[model samples]
Structures are given as C-alpha cells and as structure tokens.
Target: MRKISVQNLKGGTGKSTTVVNLGAALALKGKRVLLIDTDSQAHVGMHLGIKHSVTLFDLMTIDLSIEEAIINARENLDCIVSDKKVAVLETMLVQMPRREEILRLRARRLKNLKYDYVLVDCSPSISLMHQNALLFADYLLIPVSMDVLSLAGASSIMDSSRMLLQMYEMPLQIMGVLPTIYDGRLNMSKEVVSILETNYKKLTSVLTPIRTDVKLKEAAAAHQTIFEYDPKSRGAEDYMRLADELLELETRLDRQKQKPAEATLTA
Candidate 1:
C-alpha cells in the first residue's frame, strides 16, 4: 500500500480536515483505503462517527489485532482510530525493547493488509510516534494556513524532519504544501500564499486551494466528511480535486521509477 502522512508542526491548520476529506474522496472513487489517526485527540474517529475505547493503543500495545481495531468507516474505507488513552503508548513504550522500532514493525504489517492507500494523521508534535510515521510515509503533505506564523511553523517542521533524518533514514519525499482555509477576500491569506510560493515553490503543488467554507466545520461536527455531509459543497469539490492531483502524482512517480528500470534493460 502507498503511505501518505498529513502533518504540520503547529495545530489548527486543517491537518485532520485534510486527512478525512482526502480519504473519503479516495474511497468514493472505489479505492480501498485505511486511515490511521495518530493524534491523541482522536478527532479523526469522531469525524467518522466511530466511538470506541480501543484504538491505536490496542493495535500497538493491547492484545487487539489489527483487524480488531480497524473500523469500516465507509464502504472501501477503513480506519484505525486514535484514543484519548493513546498517551499510554508513550508510557508503555518505556518498558518495551527497541521502542522506536515498534512502528517499523506495524508499518510492515500494514503494507500487506490489502489497501490501495494508507493515510496517516500524525500528531501536531514531533514525538516518537510522529518520527515513525514519517519514516513509513512514502509522501508527506503539510496543510498550511495563509498566515506568516503558520508559514514560519512550516519551516520549523521541515527543519525537524531534516534533523530526524540524521537519526534514522527518511525514505519519504515531500508531496506538496497545501493551502487550507483560504479566503480570497482576506489580504492576510493572499499574502501568505505569496510568501509560500516565493519560498517553497519546489514543494508547492498545482492542486487548487480549498476555500474557507463554514460547511467544513459543520461537516466535521456532524461526524461526516465533506463528501458525505454535502457533496455539492465547495469543501467536497476541493478535496475531490486534491485527490485527483494526488493520484496523478502517483502515476508520474510510477512512470519515473519504470524509466530507470527500462533504461537498465536497454543498456
């Protein structure tokens, strides 16, 4: 399965919103998907309308098998919810041998679990769990609000990732920088876009930015994705567009990989 991580150093930048909507959109397109909420807040699960005591903690520390914790959130969409009790994983980790290596093992298991995509919603902080998520991720997408402070936080996240690469190899590449909660009427939002495009053109993607819609927050509160809540809404439409861009990027990567292999054979 291809792994994607939705991450940002600072909170409230639409990280969970991006994760749920993208996963829902992919599932709507008939792809088998697994969404993992690594945030201790368990907000992804709440958005999916799943209430459970067991969560990633069960998958990692408890006797719960992967299948046991996996919830069928929608047709072709499955989720491993985060628990408020997930803080226990950190406490539990101290007793385990090779604590940092546990996530590597889980990721290997997930690769064989018959999924087209595995989308991880990482915690806001750069903890051990976040490190493991980044290591397993094939691509990382950061959701940035159109503000100078948010952009500054994005830079810090990039720096942290580079530092983490020093401790363990990071096989993942940045997918793109996404603009979230964009408002065309707001000069602050417009200025943020300018700064990002000027500073991060290499990582910026071509997908259209998601406009700030009141319906998005409503959808989350209703325990539904934008598509499920209101397919006609701009939020749903934007996520669909983003999903298409991601699929196209994957196709390009596949072609790029094949070119080297073909050249070797021709040589």
Candidate 2:
C-alpha cells in the first residue's frame, strides 16, 4: 500500500480536512483507502461522522488489534480513530523498547491487508506520536495555508522531516506541498503561493491549490466530505484535482520502479 501522512505543524491549515476529503476522493475512484488519525482530537472519525469505542489508542496500547480498531467509514474506506485518550500513550511509549518503531511495527502487519492507500492524519504539535508518524510514513503530504505564519510552519515541517531522514536514514519522500485556503483576489494569498512555487521547487512537488470555500467548513460540520456534501462546490473540485495529481504521481513512480526491474531482466 502507498503510505502517506497528511500533516502540517500549524493547526487550522486544513490538514484534517485534506485527509478526509482526499481519502474520500480516492475511494470514489475505486481504491480501498485506510485513514489513521494520530491526532488526539480524533477529528478524522468526527469529520466522517463515525464513532467507535475502540480506536487507535487501543491498538497502540495493545488493548485491541488492527482489525478490531478499523472502522468502515464508507465504501472502500476504513478508518482507525483516535481521541484525547491517545495522549496517555506518550508516557507509556517512552518506557517501551524501540518506541520510535512502534507504529512502524504495527504498520508491517498491514502488508497482508491489501489496502491501496493508507493515509495518516498527524497532530500539529511536536510529540512522540509525530515522530512515530514520520517514521511509519513513506511519503509526507504537507498542506500550507495561504499566510506567512502558516508558510513558516510548513518550512519548519520540511526542515524537521529532513532532519529525521538524516537521523534515521529512512529516506521518506515528500510527496507534495498543497496550497490550501487560497484566494486569488487576495494579494497575500497570491504572494505566499508564488513564494512556495518559485522558491521551494527542490523541496517537493507544489500541488494545485485548494481555494477558499465556505462549503468546506460546512461539510466538516455536517459530517460529510466535500464530494458528499456538495459535489459541485469548489472544495470538491480542488480535492478531485488533488486526487488526480496524486494518482498521476503514483503511476509515474510505479513506472520508474518497473524500469529498473525491466532493465535487469533484459540485461
């Protein structure tokens, strides 16, 4: 499965929103998607209008198995929920051996599960769970809102990811940096996006921007994805575009991986 973590160091950058809608979009395309909410707020389940007594907290604490914590939120989409109860894990994790690899070990069990995609929604703060998320993820999908503060936060996230790669030698690829809450009419929005595209090209792919849309907020409040809430809305349009971009990227990577094998066989 393609493992991706949708994350940002700053809250309110639409990180959770992107995770829910993007997972929905991928599932709509006929792919089996698993969303793991690492945030203590447990917003992923809430966003999808799903509630389960067992959650990721239980899985991490060995109180439940992966299959037990999985919540089928929609057709082709499953979720591992989280809540404030996850905060207690930090203390316990510290005392565990190879704590940083706990999530990674749990993730290995998923290889037999046959999911097309596994998307993790991480918390905004720096925590033990955050490190574990980075270690478990094969790719990082960063959402940068159109503001200076958010932009700075995105840079910090990138820097931290780089440090983690150097320290752990995991070589986690940065899938892309998504521009969220964009408004073309606003000068600040335009400036922030311009800076990201022009200056940060080497860091990662700059994805199509998600425009500012009230329907996005309404969708979350109503417990539906943008597509389910308002398919005709700009919010839906943006996420579909994102889904398309991600699919294309995956295809490209697959082809690249195949080329080496093909050459080895031919040679």
Candidate 3:
C-alpha cells in the first residue's frame, strides 16, 4: 500500500481539499482508498457529510481498534475522523514510550486490509500528531500555496521531515510539492510556481498546479467531491489530471524497480 501524508504547515494551502478529492478520484478509478484526519478541526468528516462517532482519539488513546474507528465515507473510500479531542492526544503521548511510533504501530494492521492508497490529512502545525503522521507515512505529499508565507511553511516542513528521517532512520520520501490555489492570470501565482520548481524540483517532483476555482468551495459545501458535485467543473478536471499524474509516476517507479530484478534474472 502507498501511505501518504498530505501536509502543509501553512493553513489555507488546500491540503485537506487535495487529500479528499485525490482519494475520491483514485476510488473512482477502482482503487480502494483510506483517508485519515489528524487535524483537530475534524474538517475531513465535515467535508464529506460524515458525522463520525468514534474518531482517531478513540483509536489511539482509547481501547478502540483501528478497524472499529474506520468509517466508510464513499463507495471505495474509508475514513478515520478526528475532532477537538485529538488535541489532548499530543499531551498524552508525551509520556508514552516510543511516542512517535504510536500511529505507525496502529497502522500496520491496515496492511491486512485491501487498500491501494492511504492519505492522511494532517493539521497545519508541528505537534505530536504531525510526528506520528510523518512516522507512519512512507511519503509526504506537500500542498504549497502560491504565497510567501506558504512557501516559508513548506520549507519549514521539509526541514522538519529531514530531521525526522535522520532521527528515526525511517524511509520517508517527499513525494512531490504540489502548487495549490494557482491562478495563471496572476503574475504572482505564476512566479510562485516557477520559484518552487526552480528551488525544489531537484529535491522532489513539482506537480501540476491546482488552479483557483470557486467550484471547489461549492463542492466542499455540498459535502461532495468535485466529481460528485460537478463533474464538469475545473476543480474536477484538475484533480483527475493529478490522479492520472500520480498513477503515471507510480507506474514509472514500478518499472524502475523491476529493472534490477530483470538484470539479476538475466545474469
């Protein structure tokens, strides 16, 4: 399974929106997807019109198992919601042994389930939740907004990820830096994308920008994905294209992995 943590230390970077829509899009393509909300705001369930009874707080802090915490949000999408109670989990974890591995240890049970992708919607701050998400995920998909503050936050997130990898010796990869809330008509937005690509492309792939569209907000308000809310909207188009791009990248990586095996077989 491809475990991804969708994070941006800056709020309003469209991180949660991307995670929700991307999961929906992948599910539409017949992939079973799971989304975990690590943010105390609990907006993931709100966006999907799901009122979760048992959230991540129960799963991690209480005796509830991960299977019991999961709620089926869509046809092929499952979710583990979070709420304000999650804020207390950070303080509680402070005294726990191997606090950073808490989420990872719980998530290992997911391997027995049939899921193609696991997307984590992390809160826009550094905390115990962020550490757990980073530790659980194999890849970090950062959504960067086209603004100076967002850029700074993205850099800080990257630095933190590097530090975590060095400290824990976990194989965590920066999957890609996605440009969100982009508007090609604005020079500032265009400049931000150019700057991100120039500065970070060597470090990680720079994905296609998510153009600013009011339809995305409309879809969220309706508690539906872009595809379900308005299939013809620009938001739907951008997310679908992103899903395809991600699949293409995975295909390339799979082929690259096979090359060494093929060479060994020939020898």
TM-score for each model: 0.90, 0.93, 0.94
Output candidate 2 Cα RMSD: 4.3
In model 1, which runs have C-alpha deviations exceeding 4 angstroms? 204-206, 255-267
Which candidate number has the best TM-score?
A: 3
Q: Put down candidate 2 lDDT per residue, 5-98, tens digits, no spaces.
A: 8878988898999999999999999999999999998899999999989887788878445788888999999999999899898998999888
Q: Predict model 2's lDDT versus the native.
A: 0.86
Candidate 1 vs candidate 2, lDDT winner: 2
- Cα lDDT of all candidates, in order? 0.79, 0.86, 0.87
Instruction: Give a tens-digit lDDT track for model 1, residues 69-92.
Output: 788888999998988777667777
Pick out the ten consecutive residues of candidate 3 with the lowest summed lDDT: 258-267
The list of candidate 3 runs beyond 4 A from truth reads 255-267
lDDT of 1 at 210: 84
Arranged by lDDT, best first:
3, 2, 1
The Cα RMSD of model 3 versus the native structure comes to: 4.3
